[model samples]
Target: MALPPRQSCVDHEEISLGEIKIKTKDPACMCEVEVAPQHCSVDIKSVVIPIYLKFVDVRCSIRFKTSTLCRGSSNIVGKEILHGVSGAVGPGQILAMMGPSGSGKTTLLSLLAGRSQTNLHSGSITYNDMGYTKALKRRMGFVTQDDVLFMHLTVKETLRYAALLRLPKKLSRQEKIQRADSIILELGLDKCKDTIIGGPFERGVSGGERKRVCIGQEILIDPSIIFLDEPTSGLDSTTALRILQLLHGLAQAGRTVITTIHQPSSRLYHMFDNLLLLSNGHAIFFGRGQDALPYFSSIGLNASLLMNPADFLLDLANGNISDTSIPPELEIKLIQSKGDSKVGKPPELAVQEYLVECFSSEVAFRDSSVDSPPHAKDVILPPRREWSIGWWQQFLVLMSRGFKERRHEYLSWLRVFQVLVSAVVAGLVWLHSSADSEKHLQDQVGLIFFISIYWAYFPIFVAIYTFPQERAMIAKERASDMYRLSSYFMSRTLGDLPLNLVLPLVFLLITYFMAHLKLTVGAFLLTVLSLFLIVIAAEGLGLFIGAVMMDTKHATTLASILLLIFMLTGGFFTHGLASFVKWIKYVSYTFYAFRLLIKVQYSRSQVYDCLSATGCKSIASARVMADVDLNEAGPMEDVFALLLMVVGYRILAYVALKRMNTAR
Candidate 1:
């Protein structure tokens, strides 16, 4: 057999397959030849192998500490989440996990998918009999219950971005787009591929379509194993059935699929080849789905003629059969007999223990074809896979997506209207003031100070919500090894710059000429630049608050407090503070921005007339600067200070976000 043609080491170079050597005279073409039996062989054509993941005696337990502070004393306790639950999922098979609400179904799934790291995990999870590691994680996909998608993006755009971030770099841009299109068609989202995935305020695709788009995103990598948590929770019966059918097709095409389902219909239940039933974190049944009915029957439990098998199992697991429509006398006898078997034990507890014992005796032995424990030498853990794209590519893709999302979600015409209205109101309040009158000077000072406060307050409030909203999405993507944290942070910061600049600039343009304080082109441009910088600084501060706090309401409150502090020390409300508290003014961005605006407007002007009757004397711009305490720092120095604050706050925000994601 002959191997497929490989890329030449150089133009017109000869390659020998048997010898695993390439002959080339060009020193630049120093490519080395390597052969592997599964991918490429010197004597045979390319061979492909499918991956199947299996776990044996897998157990996970989470220890959480709860503290109560009463009378200045603390108490703590710990608990386990999952017991020794074990099962296997192979190629072309679907494993459906069914359990009551708090039975650790999602916890077990998280353990298998490596999504939770703050747990005590034991036993073995293997891919093709090799130990599971980061390399294998790259080939597996996990879909969360909630659809954490960019709500502003179309289905096609979302999948395309996923492809760009996840697909191998060897694939060209066009190839990646084609892959995304294929997945869109496969998931039946072609009908709404171009529609936005709307959120609470926007009306876009249906719930079913959004769920399909979520699945389609994970499918871009062509993963060998896919795990989903409650994929059918919100959809109607028909849509639920369709999603299961889609998973069935994927399994048929040689992918292992697993999902946790709640109260699935009988038709949907039968689609699963295997079922792992749990109660109180104990695996009660782990075998073929068809075997569940017969196993229960052998244990003296029979399903009603028309009862759905799923409902029967769920009722049996939950110990709720006595609450059903059985006859009163029969129900009493059933309850009496169940109580007699276990005296003081709860029915659910008794049933769980009995089922676990039976499953161990009957099913474990039959499935123990593999040895009880394999030697360390027998378990081959693959090396971690390299990232699909480099950092530059990741940054570009993230920045582009951020820009598009912000344009659709945040930068609306309504925001423009609000800014215009505020600008017009400010203009009307201080319309056409002159430099000669003392009252005009006071109004001009008030206007500049208000401008600083308004830009600072508005941008900070808006930007504070960014991290709280996207933290889940960021955590998910990071777990999948999609991109670097720095790339995402930089992209988001840069993406917001356009809107931040535009909104503040518009406000300045409307109010700058309307107030008639600074007539020179130089002064007007300087004022606009100063306002833009202040807005950017405020936005950076907001990002820091959002990232550090990670809760919208709490972050908002903290941001309001901090902004209040900055506003008080902003050189307008108070000219001098106690010596001990004067340092706060130095730290406040608003103080610097306000001083810069004041200096830009008055530093070069000479007062020709005075309207105040007390003194009534002409004064230079120097006297005006001394009156406002803007002489401490030059305009350039204040500008530099604001720039430093922006950079410093953004870096802190990035660090906080990185810590939060890794803390789990």
Candidate 2:
């Protein structure tokens, strides 16, 4: 006889039958103990800093300015979302907040997580009796409803990078990798460890697996409190249960977990240690999961055995209650209150108000218990430390991660094809033209101007997507204090540099030789140098645009307008313009870049012969340059101007990012 097939690595049992030939770790038993993280110097007692969270009368309101055409005036409108909601949960407890759509579940969660920017009318949110601080961020982990992940990175790569940037410097790289592997095994992700975390566009891990990856990343640093906004929002029942089960394990390990859930099955519902039922931004019930039904029953609301308690609660919250469940007193009160102004409210609002009153009157005392002083052991505040990795280390790690995440987008077949096509077309259009001819020399200048404008146009569109696409992920990581903004900004700029240069370099190599514009090494090198500056300067402008307007659509529009303006004043289109706008040419990066290109290829000594009225008269390069106004500035002057744009735009971008972070 053979032993039953092993189910999971953590929990299993031996079969009744005599096992076939197999040697277990302990030849007598067939079960394996759960694997622990392999991070160095990790003492569970010291690391598991349990957080006892409590919030009192947490209320949030938002204000917006509106214009009224009738009055022809502006008005300030305020709407209260979360109205005096309160709850508490301690270590080793799973507090599940359930409510229907627009019931303020997420709003409450955001306020508790300290991520909300709305006005708090009155509330006190504390952990271990201490207020939220920057240091506390390191001890908390937040998993938003949507899985924000690098779609191209494998599970192992994603988790390992999280560990590398998030884990303490005390842990070696190998130890960090081992820790990631441990989490992979613990979360039962070993099978898909090498699979890419897919997005809507790609096929890879399943939804359950992706959620587990998010959990794994948050837990890599052993956060004391984990806040999840509907971790199981969009998954199937089985997959959702698996995520909750994983979260249950975290609670069992003495970590506090709070999550917002929409609806759960009986089995999933029972797993919650504490339940917070909300309806219309009001707290209806806050107590043990088992006590919720009892409390509802005691309040004259009962569900049939065949009905799910969650369903019944939702029905009550939704004002879909049956006549049998309506208590005589509530019904009588409803009748007597009909003449009252409150009767004009929606049925759900009335019902929600009734539940709020019932819960508050009977169990308002429970809030006192949650507000009681916490134990001294729970007062531990994680020691605030600088970046777990040094500044340079963070830059390297971020750059490496950025490179891996974006390599596919940068080197996609379509992009390579586009570059190749553009190069081939340009090469064929000006194939083997003689430099001594005036017409060919003029064509070469036009070609140089085309190069400048093409590089500028292409890079701006490409760079606009960078910040917008990663905004959510960056916000999440920054909220957790994973890395500095400077490190991330530098890494993004530098990591893109090498790959961004690839297409331009390849284009120049192919187009320069085919066009036969200049044969000298110095001329070719200068051509490359000037084109490279244009690319860099354009990229910096794109970064600035992306940072300023973290909306890809808006950024693209603004970039188009700005680039068009630069092209018009680029000195190639027109030499004369209005005084007010003529200064734009001096400031336009493309203008300088175009000037440098012309300066590098043509010199005062060079002359081109053209068949004219005087029969093959020689025209000096100086006169040719004067025709287009390229001779106004020397090569060094244009280089200096481009250098300034290159550095200045990036600085502005960095500042914009910093301001955006602060705004958040």
Instruction: Enumerate clash totals for all models, in the order shown.
Output: 0, 0
Give the lDDT of residue 355 in candidate 1.
Answer: 62
Q: Which residue ranges in model 1 land beyond 4 Å of their true spot?
A: 1-49, 323-344, 365-382, 608-633, 662-664
Window of ten residues with lowest summed lDDT in model 1: 40-49
Error of 1 at 498 (Å): 1.3
Estimate, for each residue in 392-427, the C-alpha lDDT of model 2 and write its tens digit: 989999999999989999899999999999998999
TM-score of each: 0.87, 0.90
Model 1: what TM-score?
0.87
lDDT of 2: 0.80
